[model samples]
Target chain A: MKITFPHMGNLYIAIEALLSELKFDLIIPPPSSKRTLTLGTKYSPETICLPLKLGVGNFLEGIELGADTGLMVGGRGPCRLGYYAALQQEILYDLGKEIEFIVLDHPKEDFVRFKSQIIPLIKAGGVKALAKGLALAWEKLVAVEKLERTAHYVRPREARPKAATQVLNRALQKLRHTNTVGGIRKLCRQECDHLRDLIDRNAQEPLKVGVVGEIYTILEPFANLDLEERLGYLGVEVLRTVSLVQWLKNNLILSSLGLYSNRWLRINARGYLHASVGGHGLESVARTVALAGQGYDGIIHILPFTCMPEIVAQCILPNVSVDYQIPVLSLVVDEHTGETGFQTRLEAFVDLLSRRGQGGLQHDSACISWS
Target chain B: MTAPVYLGVDVGSVSTNLVLLDAHSLEVADKVYVRTQGQPIRTLQRAMAKIARKNQWQIVGVGTTGSARQLAGVILGADVVKNEITAHAVAALHVEKGVQTIIEIGGQDSKMIILRDGVVSDFAMNTVCAAGTGSFLDQQAARLGIPIQDFGRIALRSRHPVRIAGRCTVFAESDMIHKQQLGHSLADILAGLCDAMVRNYLTNVGKGKEIRPKIVFQGGVAANQGMRRAFEAALNAEVIVPRHFDVMGAIGAALLASETICREGATRFHGFEITESVYQNHSWECQDCSNQCEIVDIVKDGRIIASWGSRCGKTDSSSEYGMLGAGN
Candidate 1:
């Protein structure tokens, strides 16, 4: 059976490894492009968030490439994300396209169904093979993230801007062609070191900005307009609050084991937000608070436009900003987000952060007022 | 020839503004505002032509800001390129004493800037909605068979501004027509429109912010006295209009350029002679795949100087002046 899934920044690498190792034919959706966004917007609900539209767009592109079985992640929550698969199915059916869906939900409640759905795909190899395949896939995941982490650290510090980017891209291209797990790990290490070596230790300590926001927008570069890279290029080091590994640890490993709550996020967000308002609002609030206390030069909060949880979180962020005395710039991204305006605000925010880091208040804090 | 000057250019969809500031005094040496009329390059050229004829000052620094900032920055080799928000905030901070808030309305957009201690603290720009912008007023003025210049004076003559929906453009237009059909006075309808625009601005763009004292209103729409009165009545505060209200973005760009040059001690300011050169735009469908992406080429002096609009960055030669290409 041919399988396909939505793209969420390097997610395809892990999934592709798993499915291909399981001996199932797979179709990887092309990297998201403007065409994908346009198609998604054309078919999606006017008020639906951006990631959903982009996800639907990915599914369609996958279908065009002859992938019949669609895989999606589901959750029991107030977020509209859980309904994305059903809605997308309905949309595709309305357009006379057919693709079967398998939503791997919280494995706790639907373990039997999950086993039944996956057992057939892995029928070519038994449980032993399945376990091995997963192990290798997990390794690939770690390798990809490790290289990314190294790139992030070195990109802004490199004397030659864009040097780390070139290395990372080339290394990724190498990683994609490698077949064995050991090969992938070796390549990842070599690439990571190669990227690290590009950093100029003598370069100035660049301003560090914390990027915290909705999960999908944070992971998906298109949604945030490559915010991390842009910040890196602007001589700013970006420490993102979310990543696939962190998401898995928080949602899958920790939560499933009943030891999942983020201590710092919870403790910091105590007076601000009490419960999960759904769709990463709790996480966003907690993370922003944590970043503020940790002395990040600034915080960039990215939320897809009209996201319910983010909208709720946005209302409370300013209070956090005022209380912590840290500048927080919240950007709401949609299909029509003007890149020029977005870049302008970012540049200005960077300028503000740079100036503020140098102690903007010179009157000895005696005359600072919001008025 | 005069002392060295810093040139700032703001190229928006509706207008192109150029401001030349004296290097020493930091005072406006020359300023020109002209209709963009959909041709950003031509508008920039025209604006520069006017500035060129008026002065022979050596340009020490150059900056560009606005929607078409990249295009203008490319054409002019701006030392710094910023967005309208920062530009507006900088200009307001420079001109207005202890400025705390900035309310800017342009052709199709409006933004609110909140500043504390001469630094921009928070800001909001109208996103894809033109209900509370200058173009809407222009449309209403044409529909009402009244000159836009007299719109504010007529609104002041009204005894009351009939309540109108200030939500979306479609709703506002229909609501205005409905009020008109009900035999409401033209002045009352116009006044209601102004009030509706202000209400729209406050609710959408100015939501959740403290609209404090020392508020400065600028941009193309600031000339509408009716809109000014509506703001005063709504917030119960005075709104100051700067002398260079509409050209604040240009002025801010100049200020930013000046600051950059002062710190960096270098510039990429192309001379004013570029104003005389003609530039052409070209586009063609790239038959690469099913997407058939349209590649746009900005030609200068018969050279395919820059091309973009492709998903894959092929046929895109990152020219020396990266600012000129449609890099998006």
Candidate 2:
């Protein structure tokens, strides 16, 4: 049997190990990129959110590369991401791409049906095999958590940045090549520890910056133009909204915690800000709130232009800044967000923040001697 | 001193619109549209130059809208920057006291907006389709060797508009050609193309919506009488096209600026000199991590005014700047 899962922050880390133990072949989509966007845009209705298009592209690409089964998450949210799976399935079918659509629908309301559907996919010949799969999945999840924690610090100060990246890449390569949970865990820890050591020794200064935006853009590097590393270079420590641990908790345990009464939890104040109605703006607002609370110097809300939710947030962010006294910068990305224009804005915002940091705006600071 | 005027600019892919509204009277002083020939900066500069020459009023406030709003805002020193939906809806409200619907079709994009009272209730935009946009009609007009300006007049003359496939641009193009080869008159073919585009729009862009009759079609494509006829035929009702239809986005932006000025009782418009201001951009790659976010900077007077294009906030540490001395 073949089992596949959608790429979440660290979803594969846990499930891939278990699936491998069960002897199920796995198909993972390549990292998100413009190629994925083009693929999704070519097939998807132009009106849908960018993430859905990319997800569809990712799935279709994986399928073309030789997978019959595709796993997708189902959710209910204001962002309309909840409708993506069914719509994607319909579009894929229309495009004549045949695949087993395994939608892990919200298990709370559809618990019985979800279990019934999943049972067939599981290796059901023996209970021992199921137990082994569960155990392997657990190990993989733990490894992913550790990897992410180490990754959070590795970007800004790498003793040997290339070598550290090589370690992580080597671990991923080793994991992809092997089905054994133990083998993957061994490589991940070894690589992670080596990278962690490098990061720990080379740390000089860290700038603290907050990233807030739509779930897809914030989490998906390809979508957001990789803001984290840019800030990290400016000596910023990246505080992300979607962590591997939180992702697992949201998808696994807390998913059905309040399924009937509260289907969607307003989680991740650090990034999934809530300020706008239809776009990623609200999420950016929430991120601003969290960053302000954490005493971050500045906040950047990244979102696509014409995104309704972010637009709504943009309208309210000025007010949000006034209330919190946080200087919030909104970056509306599009196909035409040329790199030069983007860099200028980043440098200016950083300079603005630096000026503020040096007590330029503080009434009490006596440093302003008008020369 | 006389109250200053507010300058609003709407720069879309196909056209650049400029509007000047009197701050006190809130009346539109003047408005202009120029084709955006793949260069928004030049179009905006040219429009600003024209408005500056024609109107002797001092600019107190600047607002921007449409697709390249951010770029325009930076270039114009805009006090207010808004999206096309808000701008269109605002302009529609100014024209019609109780506009309930707004159908906007531009060169590269199309939108369906539902309004209640003067506010936008719901809206949908089509950005990734050439099938139901002005470009589609332009292509059809060229294929038939019909001047684009006369397409509407000829389409209105058609007694029996033929049916053409409209799901995809390729299919529609092929179908239009086949109908032409089948001895259909140019007017019939043009009308058929218009009908097909409208059909495609309703099915795809305008799907699952209650399109009320108190509708106003505004945008670059709203000037096309063929589309107006097609919409009228498709809905079996007359669709109102605003007088300053093509530049509604700019009008709405002007209205927004006017409203703000009314509330604040002052204008901070940088004036027409901004048109001559040097606007430049530069970029660098962030090698901080695996995700190499390209950082972009917008420069004015050799100083970085704005910087963005980062996924993780690594390159631009605005958040950290907020907290640097909080504890000290």
Candidate 3:
């Protein structure tokens, strides 16, 4: 069976490593573009968030490429993500496209159902191949995260515009092609060094801003309009509050073991939010508070327009901003977001942060007023 | 002898404003305001020509702001090009030394900038909707058969104003008609519209923002006394409207240009002769990638001066035309 899945930044890299080792025929959908969004939107409910629409787009493209079975993850939470697979299945069926979906839910939630689903995949590849695939995928995920972190650090300090981005892109391309774990490790180090070399050591210290928000918007560049790259170009060092590797470690490994995941996040979020509002809502508040204490210049909270958890978090962020004395800009984005307006807000926010960092107004107070 | 002055241009969606500030004293020497009328180039050129005929001063520095800042900057060879938020905040601070909040409602956007100790602390602009901006108010005034200029004065005559929904323009329009059918006076209906708009702005653009005393209201909409009064009534605080409210964005741009020129030691002002030059803007879809970015070119005489709007930054007027033996 030809299998396919949705894309989420570098998650596809690790997924590819795992699937290829399983010896399953896979059709990786084309990288997301305007066409993908168009197809996705045409079939999706207008009020649904951007990620699901993009997910639908990915599935359609994969189906066109002869993918009959779709792979997706299911969750039990207040977030709508838990129902995404079912809804997508309905959409595809309504369009007269017959496709099977293998949704991997948490084993802890329903061990019997989870085992029934996972056993076949494991049997297809054998236990030894499954172990090897898991190890390779883990290695690739770690390598990818490290490379991305290095890219973020070097982006703002780079001497030339878009230099760090180019190096990161090249390295990611190579990482995709290189299959061996050792090769991935070696390539990551070399590319990271290359990114560092592009930095201008003599440049002024760049402003630091933490990005905290919904997981899908935070990780996907297209969903957030390349927020990190744009901020990097504006000379602000972006500190991503979420990473796929860290998330997996926290949610999958830690939570499945009946241990507390993101203990620090839970502790920090105590005063602001007592219980999980689900889908990274508590994490968003906790990260903002932590980043503020870390002396970050500002915080940018981004979410899809109809995102419920992030919307709840957005409402509480102002109090956090006021109490912590750190400025927070909440950006709600959708398909209709204009690039010019987005760019203007980012530029203005960066200007505000830099000016605040300078400790006063950039202009002389002695200037004459027209009024 | 002519004195050196800095020029600022704000090319907004509805109007274009130009301000000339004295170089040394930094005082406003001249200003011009004109409707953009969907043609920023022609509007800016006409404004520049008017300023050129009125003043004999030398423009030493130039800056541009507003929605079309980049286009205006390229046309004027501006020394500084900045966004409307920074420009508005700067101008508001200059007007009120201890200004804490700036309520700026322009042609198609509304903004709330919060300042703490002369530094902008937080700000928010209207997103995805222009429900209660200047254009909406202008349309309402036109539909009511009232000249937009007298909308504020007419609103002031109301004793009891009816409530109108301000969530959406379509809803607000129908609500106004409903209020009118219920035998409400024109003045009261206008006042109610203003209040509803103020409520919408507060909930949307000014959401979660600290609206402290020393609130400075400036922008094209500030000219409407009804909006100013509505804001005052809602906040229960005195709203200060600056003398040159309509052109504050332009004034701020000029001030920024002056600052840049003082530090950088030179100006990029292309001089007033650009008023006589014929410029044409052209846009075409680049099929080099799936992105299919529409690249725009600003052609001055026969030479392309600037090109933008490509995602990859590869498509340029020079390279595309040079291959066809067209570029200089």
RMSD of 2: 13.2
lDDT of each structure? 0.81, 0.67, 0.86
- DockQ of the candidate models in sequence: 0.30, 0.02, 0.34
Strongest candidate by lDDT: 3
Rank ordering of all candidates by DockQ, starting from the highest: 3, 1, 2
TM-score of chain B of each: 0.91, 0.91, 0.94
Docking class of 1: acceptable
Give the range where candidate 3 chain B is weakest over 10 consecutive residues by summed lDDT. Answer: B319-328
Model 3 residue B140 CA deviation (Å) reads 1.3
Lowest summed lDDT over 10 consecutive residues: which window, candidate 1 chain A?
A362-371
Residue B33 lDDT, candidate 3, scale 0-100? 89
Which residues of candidate 2, in runs, are more than 4 Å off? Answer: A1-6, A12-31, A35-371, B1-3, B314-328
| lDDT for each residue of candidate 3 in A99-153, tens digit (9 for 90 to 100) | 9999999878878878988987898899998988888889888988898899889
Best-to-worst TM-score order: 3, 1, 2
Report clash pairs, candidate 1.
Answer: none
Instruction: Write the residue-wise lDDT of candidate 3 on B133-197 in tens digits.
Output: 99999999999899999999999888988899999999999999999998999999999999999
